[model samples]
Target: MGGNFLQSRSAIRHEVGQYIIRNIFASSGLSLYILVDTVFIAAAGGTFGLAALNISLPVFNFFNSLGLLFGIGGSTIYSINKLKDPKKVETLFGKLLLFCILLGCGFAILLNLFPTQILTILGAEGQTMAVALGYFRIIALGAPLFMCNYVCVNFIRNDGNPQLTMIATLSATLVVVFLDWLLIFVFNLHMLGAAIATLFSPLTSLTVLTFHRKNKQRQLKLKFAFPEPKTLLKAASLGIPSFLTEMSTGVSIFVFNWVLLKLSGNYAVAAYGVIANIAIVVLALSNGIALGVQPIASREYGKRNWENVKTAMKLGIQVAFGLACLLYFILVVFKTPIVSVFNHDHSAKLAQIAVNGLPLYFLSVFFASQNLVIMLSLAAIERAKMAFVLSLLRGYFILIAAVLIFAKFFGVNGVWLSVPFTEACVCALGFYFLTSALKNKN
Candidate 1:
């Protein structure tokens, strides 16, 4: 088995690359879904409506982060130990599902308790607050499904069922689009309609994943196990990078919303929302590739197959950078039309701000995409500290500092350029850490 696996580096990379592409399609589908949803909301509710959606997003992301935490964390461990200790796979899988439920419920309850306060903190006001609260309440109720779906999808992919994961994600995206059209356009439910459309995704995804659990050839099994403290910590630690990566997005939005609120007005926030929606697609492309490379690298690292690990990491990084460059070109070419999609009224100021901001915002993709792949590779190889540091650098430390300094000096332009600056710096650090580690091994 070891010799066959070692000899198949070319085949492995090809196979893994294909697998990663499928995930890209799924993630891209979801990204398009968000963009479509934004269009619908903007058309129906206009600036205030769009801003409301933006306000609620950080809350959604916070809950989603918790799901990713357990899901990615547990899934990584299961991938590493699947062959060595298969029984532990079942235990970890079961425990993670349980944990997702409990934590998701806790979060939902908290959202319910503090709806007004949360909205206020998210920078919602008056009309935006009213619209945002409606979206928030309904979406919060879906927390359990949301969290569990994350666990199911990640585990299914790592269990050699990437196809199923892709199917589920694509199917859910289609459903969301259909529901958004029907509810928002036809029923005229507006913000509530949009929220309902999104709320159904977790259910759709979980239903598809259930088939994998019942499959006879399934590698991940559901088995009851009392959660051990040590095991739970291990899972959280492994998944922290993913958690931070996600939460950082929410944090960025929060910071951007606050800064934009002060610099211009709610219209600026709405315009930023359009740019952020586009960002969803760009980041999703990178995330899909990173997730795709993770299982392959982890399994090889588990076997001490250093050469295969290097090949996989190199291929993944190359794909990441290639996709980033292509995306930036497309964004530049279509900047006006893309901004118009969300601006609806074609407000010149909104269009100009977004068009000006997009190029600068997009430069981050070059570094950010490679950073995600590298960070995930480090996590897969059990370099959790390194991965965590990368997450902090991009997600928190570097990003926050850059945003503060830039936004202070350059206003909104500073806001746009800060992302790329932070990412470029982190990419440099990632290079040093990755190279030094590889040299030490040699």
Candidate 2:
């Protein structure tokens, strides 16, 4: 090529690098803090406490996922649009903000009103039922804040303010960790304290959000607008797949929890909780790595820069494998100490069982990483249907099948083993879809 070609390539690479740092730093930091905080809470609370927290986590994550749908789906679209039509970006942001707020309130009311019913469906029996209800009720109080914070942070990243997003998340997490210690340990409120601390996290995040938006948001004003039925419809259409992908996990977790509780007892529930809890920590980091790849892929796809998209996928997979390896080592090496951090001897065998199964659980990180790339990359390119298809394969179809078949035959070990098998299957399918899309595009 020529100097012009070389300069353009250099610019693309620079943008990709910035995108990577911002995506990984902001997402990973938020996930790590939350994961660590969960582990610490489990440790402080004991078997029942941890089980209750674990039981309730899927519900909380589901709500958070709603935020992900509008915020992330909107942000990606918004970013691509700004690259071309900067003036029209506000329409996108305005609609999403409005829709998310309404949905947030709706979800809050539904969850609060149906806490007992929801917990019962999710396998709450005795104390597990009580603790789940307590935790759920408190967190339900902050639903509005939770939804708003999602829009704010994702928008910051969309606006190319990763540093601000990182700082904002870190501040909220740091505050939650401190408050968690004081409320759960010093005051001994158990699940109630955990719930309050959970509420405080989003509140702190919202504070940072307000500060960030007040200063930097010139493109999109956040005033309350009457519900735009079309905006909510569009968001739901574009975002539903992502929303379902996460919602499926909540369903899966309930199944997983119920199965474990059935196969063993409270100890088993607590043990599996340890594994699930740690998995969240790793999954969050993996998500960070994958999300870092998203903007690069999205921006490149916008300009039809397919090679960078492919390379970024490769890089994200490598990062995911590297992270999984690190996590595997910790599980194998420090399994006892880490498990101890969550529970004592009551869960010793369960912890060992978890350690035995840790590597298997992460074996598909490479594939999982690729699947994530294809999903978001497609969505970023406005291929929402394709994204939904892949999401369904991984989240619902493959995972559900794997869990049932494996768990039926192998028991709890089967439950753990299902992760990789399903991930590999869905990833292969995702690859097929991505290749077809590329062929059609080219």
Candidate 3:
């Protein structure tokens, strides 16, 4: 499979590119379901319910970061090494699967031990605390399923059966939505129903992905193997950028929640929640494009095919920019309608805050997404150091500085502008490193 993609001509390359993108696009159905989930929560539980869910997002992201760290990191290495040694591919997959389960369990234990403390830290209080804790406890129990499902899906995709991956994702989306309606609307379980719906959805993904084992072209194996410290470290180093890229969301959201709570109380947080959910769709599109090209680029580089590497990166950037423009226009033109969808009770103040913030906030996706693609490109080629720097700068350091400085000066509007400013800075640095890394190849 590696040789086939690596050796394919323009026609096949285009097909491969489209195939990868379609699979990734389908995989993002989780975000779509999240959008619907938010709508349901807002309709049933109101602004405070929405706020509670948003507050709990950081914890969910923390566990998700752990999954990406192992899933992507190990898959990157697996893509490159599988062309040279098949046996080692199985070993690496085994190690990543094991690590994912351990990390998930560790997170579950932490949640069980510190549920109240974590809820307080997330800015929950009284009614919101009750709602958020209900959701968190149920989600915590599914940590292992979430983490392992993420790892398996990534492995399945890179194993040469992206169709199966796409099918798995779609299955999960259907199951989640159906259950959400049944449990939340029919049964009136409210937050508990929402959490249960989200939790069980991943099991469908895990179940569907198991079909990949029957594929003759599939190479990812789950044969049990003793873990090696060095291999674990290697995968972690490659995957750290993904972890930080994801974890950055949690960290920034945590900061934003605190700042918004300080500035305008629960209503403000609720407004931001609406915007954040919209941002997820945009981010997922960009991620699909970037991740779509990763295996291709990584494989070509492993075989020392520089021209193919350049082609993949160029295609990814073009698609990201195109998608970004489309998303921005949609947000600007339909700002009011979009806000109203999640605003539920039609609070004028909440609508005003979110509507005013959406334009500037959505613009950030343009540069921020391109930067993410470049960061992933660097990581794919084994330029881990440059990738790490880019992730750290955008995901944490620059993000923190931009949000604080902008909020202090621009007030609420500044808070909205911080994301683009941070991305612009990182996008510039991303190009610099991309140029340097590509130049070194010459």
Ranking by TM-score: 1, 3, 2
Scanning candidate 2 in windows of ten residues, the lowest lDDT window is 216-225
Error of 2 at 405 (Å): 0.9
> Which order, best to worst by lDDT?
1, 3, 2
Who wins the TM-score comparison?
Answer: 1
lDDT measured at residue 214 in model 1 versus the true structure, 0 to 100: 68
Error of 3 at 395 (Å): 1.3
lDDT of 1 by residue, 1-442 (tens): 8878656987878877987898798667656667777999999888888889888888777777888888888889999999998866768888888877888888888898899998998899999998889889988888888889888888888998888888888888889999999999899898899889997787887888788966667778787667788888999998999899988988999999999999988878988998888887789889999898899988988898887788888988999988988999999999888888788776777788888999989999999999988888888888888889999999899999898899999999999999999999999999888776666653
Stretches of candidate 2 off by over 4 Å are 2-7, 213-218, 305-311
Clashes of 3: 0
lDDT of 3 by residue, 14-113 (tens): 9547755765566477466777788889988899889998998888778778877888888898999897877667678877788778878888888988
Clashes by residue pair, model 1: none
TM-score, predicted candidate 1 vs. hidden true structure: 0.96
Quote each prediction's TM-score: 0.96, 0.91, 0.96
Error (Å) of candidate 3 at residue 335 is 1.2
